[model samples]
Target: MTDSSSSPITVRYTCPHCDAVHSIDRAPDLADRSVTKHSQPGWEYATPDDDLEVRETADGIAFICGEDGPVTDLEGKQIEGCGRPFYLNFVRFEQGVELDPNPATYGGPRFDFNG
Candidate 1:
């Protein structure tokens, strides 16, 4: 049996604007830093006027816009509203089993782990 604890963990980040997803393999030491970075305002290049809300989900974590909401596009620098919320989903792969290429399809970042 393989020790799941030491297995590589994949973190998927979904964009609220275009439903575009970005996935990154989590390094044990840098996990907290990655989470903190995503939990900050304008992390997605959103306007500074907007507030960010962090919530703990079964899977990993979620970052959503507060009252002001998503008021700008980071890449385009436009004032378009992306009302959708972003999610950070975590998944573990068993030994020899291939990891899913698209973690976004795992259904909105709901994981069984508390942290």
Candidate 2:
């Protein structure tokens, strides 16, 4: 049942038993999405299970959500799911809004990749 036929689509859920991984493409709405807590800070983590979701499902691999954009209250925590710490460059946006995963600029993003 899992193959190219199910490519580009896979069910996703955290194991209720032990936070294990769970995936299935054709579930009967039992695992339907409800608002889930953003799990990261600042994003207001959609606590009740309502909202749109974009996800990927595979074995042993858990979700690492950007949660609308980035996690807040970093207080030194790795920016949730990306293993990145907060940088001061992004202090302007309304906290959790993004056109893309990373920061964007009118012309292009400025990165310190050269060094």
TM-score computed on alpha carbons, candidate 1: 0.27
TM-score of 2: 0.19
Clashes of each: 1, 8
Worst 10 residues of 2 by lDDT: 52-61
TM-score of each: 0.27, 0.19
lDDT, model 1, position 85: 52
Local accuracy of candidate 2 as per-residue lDDT tens digits, 36-96? 2222223222211222232112111223333323332324233434332221111223465
Model 2 misplaced regions, further than 4 Å: 1-8, 13-17, 23-38, 47-115
Clash pairs, model 2 backbone: 34-49, 34-50, 35-48, 35-49, 35-50, 36-49, 38-45, 41-72
Instruction: Tell me the lDDT of model 2 at 43.
Output: 27
